[model samples]
Target chain A: MLNYLARRLVLALITCAAISVLTFVIIRLPPGDFVDAYIANLASNGSMVSAEQAVAMRHEYGLDRPVVVQYALWMGRVVRGDFGVSMMWRRPVTEVIGDRLWLTMAISVSALFLTWTIALPIGIYSAVRQYSIGDYIATLLGFMGLAIPNFLLALILMYAGFRYLGLSVGGLFSSDYAQEAWSLAKFWDLMKHIPLPACVLALAGTAQLIRIMRANLLDELRKPYVVSARAKGLSELHVVLKYPVRAALNPFASSIAYLFPYLVSGSIIVSLVLGLPTVGPLLLQALVAQDMFLAGTIVLLLGIMTVIGTLISDLLLMWIEPRIRLRGRA
Target chain B: MVEQVMTNPGAIESGGHMLSVRDLAVEFGQDRGSVRALDGISLDLRAGRVLGVVGESGCGKSVTARAILGILDRPGRLVGGRVLLDPGTSAEQNLAALDPNGAALRAVRGGRIGLIFQEPMTALSVHYTVGNQIIEAIRAHKTLSKAAARAATVELLREVGIPRPELRIDAYPFQLSGGLRQRVGIAMALACAPDILIADEPTTALDVTTQAQILALLRRLQRDKGIALMLITHDMGVIAQMADDVAVMYLGRIVEFAPVRRLFAAPRHPYTRALLRSVPDIRAVPRARLATIGGTVPHPGARPTGCAFHPRCQEMIAGRCETTAPSPVPAGLEGASCFHAESVVQEAVV
Candidate 1:
């Protein structure tokens, strides 16, 4: 087990390294850098800048250095907790994203929990009572959830919330509490504003999870062990819950790698439409505005999360299934 | 609907029957219609006796086992039947009459009756330890503490001839060899000391030496525990060795049933005789081709008009056997479901 953990950690580091290189290269693939965008903006607004001042600015920002050298410098500072600076926001990349990071994580995590808690039972029920009216209804609704776009759902819900409940349907909090620091009332206000966006984000994921879990469980329910378990005089409920359900959980556990990153960067259009302050919208804006430091940091963070999620889920699978652990150990 | 004679209760009871199945019919439904998989099959089992049910593949041997245990898969309906278990009392508990999911049936299932499946690798849940599974079966019918159940499971493992059962207890199903896994299956079935132990093709998946060892272990266990054993297999050798009574089945019905010695000595039914002849003899000339039954068991949907086996029987009566299904008729201590049973024997002698 110690060796396994060490091996996974090394693999995770290599993955992060590859992700960092890719994020850096892909973010720089645009026609110009942040300096060029700034200069163009200045020119478009009919502003003049002296050549000396422009050169000074380039030198200060390390924009005058070679691309490889600039990447090394940025990485060195990143290891020291400095993600360079976002030219668009005129602030350090970390500071610019720090506030949105917590809000995004909160919504994503809540949405994920909601998706699982609802999907698990519904999926099991649908599979166990296959072709029944309840299963048919769940299947229909699952397809609908998968078919309808998250952003469109967000728009529809926002409109419904405003029209029916007279509720403010966008942002993390009401205007008064938006800028407020932590307090019971502000927390409550934030909680009240979370449901619409979280529901929109979770719909597609929950539906997909239901379909996957249902299919997996149905396959497992047909296994001989389940039949023998029933023949052992175990109640139908006990047989389904204890035998096949554990095997069915394999598919769900394996999805964790995609799930963590999905929660972090889900429904970009939905985030934009709902005006929710999440990493999705921020990453989109940074990529569009040629903010290399911000885009690279966000993508690198997502990649790191993916690696860690995979490691955690792998360890979890080994704990739950002895077959995997024994195979790995051997 | 065809009127069928229910098993005679007095005759079975006089034979010391522990469980009696009467006029059992099972049907599997598809889109077009249903086909009877088990048709009007009856048998009597007594404690401490090994009753061998022999048949070719897909001839309803496993189906009979499942029906007795009330574990038939979906779309398999018990159209008519009564599985009566005499629990050392005047009144017999009708398993077929019990609600499949009800408590009474559940109590009878793994408590009074136990089942060991053919494929041990797939029968035991791979995710759990063998001991854990055995303990589960033990606890299913008994109100034992976890520690007690664990001890019992270890004892059972040891009894089934598994070496180092204490260590092997924690091993998963995949960790054990086919024979060891089968031993675990036996241990599980015997956990509750069921009066009737239904082993459905238990050694069919094992190697020859392992199969003999398993058969020896089952015989030893039956001797020690005195449990009624129903060994279902297609191997006549297994039946000859282990069974006190032998039942030959074909096309979803018992073609002949008699004491093992009587069955092999004067096999009355042509199907049973053909089955015996098909077995290659060690003393026979090596170059000679082995005898085989002419045709396969008829498909359930396209069964022969009268006797289901008439098409394949060499002694088939053209006009009579093609138009009417013969009920089981007695010949000495044996019974055969063929109209020309006496003539078939006389013809064989001539």
Candidate 2:
């Protein structure tokens, strides 16, 4: 097991390195650099800058160097925990991302929790009582959840909250708590605003998970082991939960690998629509403004999360299923 | 029904019948219509005796086992039946009449009767150690402490011929070979010390050598425990070796039920004779074509109007066999549901 863990860790490091290079190249792929966008912003604001000034700014930002040198230089600083500065925000990338990253994770984790708690029982029900009225209803609702876009759902929920409950459910905090320091009230206010965006983010994932879980469980319920378990005199509830449900949970556990990346990237449009202070919207803004450090850092973090998520899922699968654990030894 | 009761009068009179399935019928609902999977299947499993149910594939052998246990899969319902389970001490209870999901049936299942499934590879849960599964079965019926149950599980493993029971108790089902896994399955079925054991094609998935070994183990265990064993298989050799009585089923119905020796020596039904003839014999002429029963068992949905075996029977009576179903006729301790059981025997002699 230790050997397996060490091997996976090494692979994760190589994956992160690859992701860093990819993120840097993609960020630089646009026609212009941060200097160009900066100059354009200044010109649009009715200010003029000479070509020399623009060149000096490029040199100052070290953007005039070849892409390889820029990547190597950025990587060197990144290894030391310095993510350079966001050209747009005029702040260190870490500082710019610090609280936003936490908030993003907070929302994502809550959304994931919601997804599992709702999907698991519903999925099990849909499978065990397949073709029942409740199964039909769950299937219909799951399809609707999958079909509706996240941003559109966010808008609809926000409007419904405002119109029906007379509550503004757009952002992470109400006006009174937006600028307040951490306190019970601010936390409570944040909690109240989180559900709308979290639900919107979880809708698609929940729907997909329910379908996966139902299909997996349906396959398992007919397996001989399930019948054997039933013949063992286990209660119907015990038989279903212990045999088929546990087997069905394999896909659910493996799905955690994608959950990390999905939460980081999948919440982008919903975050933008809901105006949630998350890394997704920040990454989008950084990308649009040619803020390489900020965008690259966010993307690299997402890549790292994906690798770590995969490792966690692998470990979870091994723990749940002994067959995988034996294979891991090989 | 009177003839049915008369056919197994010796077993009922001897008070040795552990499970008596009476005219049990099961139907599977499909898109086209409901097909009768088990039509009036009747048999008696006597204590300290092995009753082998032999049939071709899809002939409802497994369905009979599942129906007796009241664990038939969905869309398959017990349309009519009575599974009278007499566990010696308690009053006889009709299992088929009980609610399938109720507590009464739950207690009887795995408590008064145990089932050994075919395909050891798929019968045991991969997530659990064999020991854990056996312990669960043991505790399901008995109020034993966890350690006690574990000890009992190891004992069962040892009894079923699993070597190094202490070490093997922790191994998952997937880690074991097919033979060892089936041993675990047998141990699990015997854990509750049920009076009746229903082994549905228990050795079908095993290799030839493993099949022999498993059958031997099952026979020894059944004898030692004096459990009424209903061994379902398609192998006539297995029936001859292990069974006290044999049931020959064709398309959901038992065409012949008799003592093993009599059935093999003077098989009354033409279907049973054909089945015995189809068994390859080593004494036959070298390089000769092997005997085979013509035609396959028809789909249950398209069953013939008369005896289910008539279409495939060489002794099928012309007009009578095609139009009218033949009910079972009692003859001492044996019976055959064929229109010309005597004629078939006389023709064989001629």
Candidate 3:
């Protein structure tokens, strides 16, 4: 097991290296850099810089250097815990991302928690009582959840919250608490604001997970081991939960590999519509402004999260299933 | 319905029968209409005796076992029947009448009665170790501590002839060979020490050598424990070797039932006679044609009007066999559901 884990860790490091290289290259793929966007903004305001001044600005920002040299310099600084400065915010990229990253993680984690807790039970119930009225109702609602886009759901929810509850249901904090430092009141306010966006974000994932869990459980319920479990005089609940449900959970475990990356990146449009102060909006701003340091760092972090998620998924699968564990040993 | 005479009157008179399935009928609902899968099937399983139920596929052999255990798959249900399980001390209870999902039936299953499956490969759960599964079965019906259950599981593994019980107990189902897996299945069935064991084609998925070993193990266990064994199979050789009493089924009904020796010695029903003849003789002339029944078993939806086997029987009375179903006739300790059972025997003798 140690050997297997060591091998996986090595593989993960290699994958993260590839992702960093790719993120760096992709961020540079656009025609112009942050300097070009800055110069264009100055010209639109009827204020222009001389060619010599523009060259001085590029040189100061290291944009005048070759791409390879710039990459090496940036990578060396990144290795030493420096993400450079965000050209858009004129601050350190780490400072720009710090609190927003936490808020993003907070919302995503809560959404994921809501998804599994709601989806698993409903999925198991739908499968065990297949074709029943409850099953039919769940199926209908699940399809609706999947069909409606996240941004649309966010819009509908925001309207509903404002109209009926008389509550301002946008962003991660109330206007008064938005700029406050850490406090119980601000944390409570943040908590109050989390559910709306979390629910919006979780709807599609929950619906898809329900469908996947239901289908997998349905297939497993017909297998002979289920009959064997039943024949052991186990109650219907015990039989379904112990045997088929475990077998059905395989897909759920492996899905963790995608869930992490999805939670970070998939919330982009939803974050935009809901006006949640998350890393998603910051990344979008960085990318649009061609702030290579900020955009590349965000992309690289997403990639690293994906690699870690895959590793966790593999370890979880090995824990749950003996077949995979033994195969890993061999 | 014709009044069918019950076979095995001697066992019934002696009050030795542990499980009795009487007038058991099952039906499956399809898109168009319902088809009767088991039609008034009756049999008796006595203590320390192996009752072999032999038939071709779709003859409702497996359905009979499932119905008796109250584990029939969906779209199929017990339309009418009484599965009387006598524990020899208390009043006998009709298992068929018990609510399928109720606690009473749950206690009866794997508690008072156990069932072994056909396919060993799929019968056990791959997620659990063999030891864990057996321990779960043991604890389900008994009030035992975890350590006690684990000890009992190890003992069961040893009882079923698995080598190095301590280590092999931790192995998953996929790690074991087919024979060893079936042994694990047997250990699971015998975990709670049930009064009756219903093996549904237990050896059908095994090779000949493994089949013999499993049969031997089953016989030894049955004898030592005095458990009533209901062995369902399609192999005549298995029936001959393992069964004390034989019940021959055709189209969801038992056509003939007798002691194993008597069934082979003086087979009465034409179906049973054909089944016996179809078994290849080791000393027969080389390069000779093998004997086979004339046609396949008919679909249950399109059952013939009279005797189900008449279409394939040589002695089928033209108008009589085609129009009227024959009630079972008692002959000594055996019985056959055929009008020309005696004639078939006489013709064979001639």
Candidate 4:
């Protein structure tokens, strides 16, 4: 097990290195650097920066160096917690990400927990009482949830809140609480506004989870081991939970790899529609404005999360299934 | 029913029968109609004895076992029956009359009567260790602590001939060979020291050598533990080797049942005689076609009007066999559901 852990750590490092190189290359693939975009913006605004000053700006950002050297230099700085300056925001990439990363992660984690809590019970119920009225109702609701786009749901909820409740419901906080210092009122306001965007985000995921979980469990419930467990005089509930449910959860557990990156970089359009500050819209803005350092950092962070998520999923798989753990040895 | 009660000499044994199935009937609801899978089946199982039920596939041998254990799946319901379990108690209780999911039946199942399935490969949950599954079975009836249960599990693994029981206790079912998995199944079934152990084709999925080993182990366990074992199989040779009493079934009915030696010595039913002849002898002429019972079994949905075997029976009486099913009658020390039992016995004597 220790050897397996060491091997996974090495593999994770390789993945991060590959991702860093890929992110550097892809962001730099487009023609012109941040200075070019800055100069073009200055010119479009009927202002001008002298040629020498532009060259100085290029030198300041190390755009004058070869792409490989620039990448190496950036990677070196990143190792010491320097993410270079965001060309558009004119601040450190970390400062630009500041509190937004925490908020986004918080929301994503809550949405994930919510989705699983709702999906697991509904999925188990639909499968155990298959073809019953409850199953049919859950199936209908799941299909409906899948059919509705999250951004549309956000827009609809926003309009309904304003129209019917006569409330401003776009941002994650009220105007008063937005600029207020951390206080009981601000915390309460944040709680009140969390449900809308979180629900909008969780809807599609919960639907898919229910369908996948139900299908996997249905397949497992038909297997002979389930019958064997039942023949042991276990109660119906105990049999379903202890035996088939563990096997049925394999697909859900493996989805952890995708889930980490998904939470860190949530639905950009939904975030835009709901007027919430999250990493997804920030990443989009950085890319549009040609802020290479911020864009590259965000993408690389997502990559790291993916690798960590996969490592976690593998560990969880081994923990849950003894068959996999004991497979290698004679 | 009266004739059955009168002819069953083993019913008068001192300890009484461990399990008695009288007029046990089971039916499956098909798209076409209800198909009777077990019809008026009666049998007696005694402690420390093995009852071998032998028949072709779809002859309801497995169904009978499932019926006794109350593990039959949906669409297959007990239409009529009485499973009288004595359990060497003050009063016998009718298992068939109890609700399958009620607490009373739950205590009886897996506690007093245990079942081992046919396919060992799929009989155990892959997610659990052999020890965990066995521990689960042990704790189902007994209130042992987890550590105590673990000790019992290792002991069971050791008892079943698995090496390094302490280390193997943590091994998953997939890690073990098919023989070991079946051994685990036996260990789980015998965990509660059930009064009756129903092994449904337990060795059918095993290789011949492993089959013998399992049979021998089962015989030893039955003798040592004094548990009534119901061995269900399609192999007649296995029945001869393992059974004290043998039941020969055809189309879901026990056509003949007797002491193993007596039944083999003077088989009365035409089907049983044909079945015994179909076994290839080591001394048979080298290149001859093995004798086969002609024709396939009738589809349950399209059963013959009277005797289910008449269409393929060479000794079938045209008028009598076509219009009426034969009731069980005494033939020497055995009971056979054949109208021509007297003639078959007389011919054998001649």
Candidate 5:
């Protein structure tokens, strides 16, 4: 078991190395550097600077160095709590994304739990009661959830918020976040604003989970073991819940191996609409502004989160399914 | 003295029979598109002896068991039939027509009729421990407290002859070996003191030695509990060892049904004859080349008209064999369907 974990960790490191290299190369691919962004912003203010001054700024920021040197330097510092400065936010990348990371994790994971809690019972019920009116209705609902894309659902809900509830759509944290420090009152206030966007984000993720879980349960219901369970004179509820449902959960739970990492990607669309300061929007801004240092760090961070999430899930799978652990040890 | 009447079907049981399936036909989907998994099948399983239904793949042996258990899903319809089971004391009920999760059938199934599946572990839940699952099953049928359910489960596991049943009650299905898992399956099935146990290829997935052990265990249990055994398998050897009577099914129809000795020693139907000939008996030392039944079990959509087995029947009797399906002809024990039974017997004995 220890050897297996060691092997997995080595593979994880290789994966992280690949991701870091890709992030470094991809972030630098665009034409302009930080100088161009500064020049363009200052030009709009009618301020002109000499080519020498530009050269001086480039050298100061270490942008004058070769791409590989810059990548190595930034990665080295990043490993020690220093993600380069964000050109747009004019702050450290970690400081900018730190609190937002918590918010995103809360929204996404909670939505995931809600999705499973709802989907499991409904999926099993519909599958066992297949061809009945309830089954038809549940299937119809699943179809509707699938058809109406999550982002579109978010837009519709936001539109409703504007029209009916008169709720503010200014992406969770108010405009004055640059001035205020983190506080309990501010956190609750942030959550209050987080609801619509979080829900919108959850809609797609929850829908995906519901559909997958339903499929899993339906497949399980068809297994020979389920038939035997029913023959054992078990109640319909017990049979579905106990025998079929567990076998069905095998595939679904294994996918949980990637769920948290996918959660980072899942938050991208909703985060864009809400403008809640998360890595998604931060990564986007860094790309557009040609902030290579900041972009590389954020991408690396996200990659790390994804890798870590998958690893933890893999370890959890052993506890969740004793079969895997026993097989491994044996 | 009891075997006198040649024409009349001798009921397998001296006491009241547990399950009597009469003319059961399972057609999946529409008429033209429908699959006849079991066509006009009739049989009886008494309170004790194991009545084995042996056949090749897709011969409707498993379908017959599923129909009794009320587990057949959509696309597999029980078109016509009556699965009459005497619920110990209640009125005889036809399990065929009961809804998949209907109240009355639920009372009969898992309540009166227990089933052991081909793959035992897959049928047991992975999320639940084997002990808790059986306890829940016991609680499902009767009013048993948690402690009582646990006690019943331990005792039931012991009854199935699991080693250190009390210690192993907490073990999950995947933790146990294949043979032990099968024992758990049996224990779960017998929790309700069911009168009939339908074991569909119970030993098909086990090792040969484990298979023998399970067969022995089942026989002993049947004797002790007086529970009927409707064993379904494709292995003719298993049928020969365990079955009191044997039914040979071909393309969803019971082509031959008789006492095991008679069916094996002097087979009647062509399909049955081919099946017996194919099996290499160690008893026959200088064995003739084992007969091979040509062609696979045809899909439900393409089953030939009239006789479903005629396309492959070696004893094709002019137009009658291919054009008009032969029905069961009453012989020594009960049912055996074939046009040239007398001639086949004559050839076999000579």
Candidate 6:
């Protein structure tokens, strides 16, 4: 088990390196330059700086160096917690991404909870009472979720909120976030804005989850042990939950490692639709402007998030189920 | 209708019959006319005895076992019958009469009568370790602590003669060999220590040597545990070795039920006689032809009218055998459900 873990850790490091190299290369290949765009923005504003000054500014940001040296320096700074300043926003990339990362985490995590917590039981019930009215209804709902694209769903929800409730799904804190103390009321107001985006994001995911759970449960219901459980005098509920459901959740449970990626990537689509202020928005802006350092940092941060998600999923598997090897105990 | 009281024999005694099944019939559906899975099937499985049910494929051996466990999939059901189990109590309950979702029936399954499925590979969960699956089986019925359940699961793994049970206990079902997996399944079934164990073709999926080992393990467990066993199989040799009482089923009905010795020695049912002759033996006269129960079983959907077996019977009497169904009747200390039970066996000379 130790050997296995060590191998996995080494593989993880290799994966991280591959990701950084890919991100760096991809950012370099994109057309245009942030320095030129900045100089143009300045020129349009009638603040004509000397050519030497513009070159000096570029050098100060180390854009003067070749790609490899710049990457090495950037990697070195990353290792030392000195993520470079944002090219477009002109703020330290870490400070810019930190708060937004936390917000994204909260929203994604909450949305994930809502999806699994509700979908699991519903899917199981649907599978158990399969071909019944309940199943048909769930099936139809699942189809709707699958068919309606995320951006459209978000737009429809946004339009409906205004048309019916006469309310807009925005205004973080409703009095500006600075005045809020992260109090319950402030959080509730914050949550009101989140639903439109979160629901839009979760619709596709929860639909997929329900389908997975239902198909898995349907498969498990046919197992011999399930029959054995029923034969053992256990209640239908107990039989379904204790034996079959636990077993059925195994594949999905293993995939929990990938959920963070699902959350992060899936959030990008919904984030764009909602016009939310998150790392994803900044990421899109950085990419469009070819701000390599800023875009590279976002990609790197996402890589870190992927690692964290995988670790959590692994630990969770060991905790919820003792069958897995944790640091090689068995 | 009479429940268990009228059907079960000698209910008061300790060694009395545990289950008395009578006239149990199962069919697929309406348009797809039901196959007589268990036609007028009557038998007694007493405490502390092994009843090996033997027959060829589609003979309803598995159907009988599934009926007992109440685990039959859809389009298959107990259309008519009674499963009277003693339940180690004075009041023998009619298992058949209970609703599918009844609490009483739930209490009986996996509690009083445990089941061992045919495919051990498919029987245990791939998701959990062997130990966890066994622990789940234990904890499902008993309210043991997680630690206690784990320890008990490991103990059962050891009890089934698995080597390095402590280490291998955490291994998944797929990690074990065929023989070990079967042993694990045995341990799982025996976890509850029920009065009856129904091994539904337990060894059929395994190789011959592994099959022998599994059979021996079951026999040993039966001897030590004093639990009645219903060993379902199509192999006559296995029945010969393991059965105290043997029942021959044909077309979802028990055509003959008797003591293993009596039935094999003086087999009454033509199906049983043909099955016995089909098995190769050194005692057979040289240049003699091997007997075979010629013809396929009738398609379950299009069952022949009257007797379900008449189309295949060699000594088919046009009117009595084909036009009229014969009910179960006594054939010595046993019973054979055939119109010509007496005439067919009277001239029987192997």
Q: Give the C-alpha interface root-mean-square deviation per candidate.
A: 0.9, 0.7, 0.7, 1.2, 1.8, 3.1
Candidate 5's docking class is: medium
User: Candidate 2, residues A93-115: lDDT per residue as tens digits?
Assistant: 99999888788888999898999
Tens-digit per-residue lDDT, B159-227, candidate 6: 888999989888887778999999998888877777688998999999999999889989988767667
Residue-level lDDT of model 4, residues B1-350, one tens digit each, is 12323444344344347798888899998546899999878888886788999999999998898888777776789989789887345558898888877777778778888888888879898887788898998898789999999998888888888889899888888888989888989888878777688999999999989999999999888777667889998888998999999989887788998899988998888999999999988899999889999999998778897888999999989898989988764322467888888666668789
Q: What lDDT score is found at residue B101 in candidate 4?
A: 72
Span of 10 residues, lowest total lDDT, candidate 1 chain B: B1-10
Segments of candidate 4 deviating more than 4 angstroms: A31-59, A160-168, A327-330, B1-15, B27-36, B87-90, B163-167, B266-274, B291-350
Candidate that would win on TM-score: 2
Better of 2 and 6 by DockQ: 2
Cα lDDT tens digits for candidate 2, B1-350: 13323444454346377778888999999646999999888788887799999989999999999998899999999999789987343577999999998889988889878999899989998888888888999888889999999999888899999999999999999899999999999989988888789999999899999999999999998876677899999999999999999999899988898899999998988889998998989999999888788998899999988877888888778899889888764422477888777556557679
Model 6 iRMSD vs. native: 3.1
Weakest 10 consecutive residues of candidate 5 chain B by summed lDDT: B1-10
Q: Can you tell me the DockQ of model 1? A: 0.70
DockQ of each: 0.70, 0.87, 0.79, 0.55, 0.55, 0.35
- Superior by TM-score: candidate 3 or candidate 6: 3
Evaluate model 5: give its TM-score: 0.84
True contacts kept of each: 0.58, 0.85, 0.87, 0.62, 0.77, 0.60
TM per candidate comes to: 0.93, 0.95, 0.93, 0.88, 0.84, 0.83
Question: For all the candidates, what are their Cα RMSDs to the real structure?
Answer: 4.6, 3.9, 4.5, 4.7, 5.4, 5.1
The per-model lDDT (C-alpha) reads 0.85, 0.87, 0.88, 0.85, 0.77, 0.77
Predicted candidate 3: interface RMSD? Answer: 0.7
The runs of at least 3 residues in candidate 1 whose Cα sits more than 4 Å from the true structure, single-residue gaps closed, are A40-57, B1-15, B30-32, B328-333, B342-350
> Candidate 2 has which clashing residue pairs, if any?
none
Model 4, A1-330: lDDT tens digits are 677778888999999999999999989988988888888888999999999999999999899999899999999999999998998888999999977888788788888888999999999999988888999999999999899988988888889988998866877789998988789998889888888788888888899889988999999988878877877887778889998898899777788999989878888999999999899999999888789999999999999999999999888877776665656211
Mark the regions of model 2 whose C-alpha exceeds 4 Å error after superposition: A44-46, B1-15, B30-32, B87-90, B329-333, B342-350
Model 6 residue runs over 4 Å out of place are A36-60, A171-188, A262-266, A311-330, B1-15, B28-36, B87-90, B126-193, B207-210, B213-217, B220-227, B282-299, B304-342, B345-350
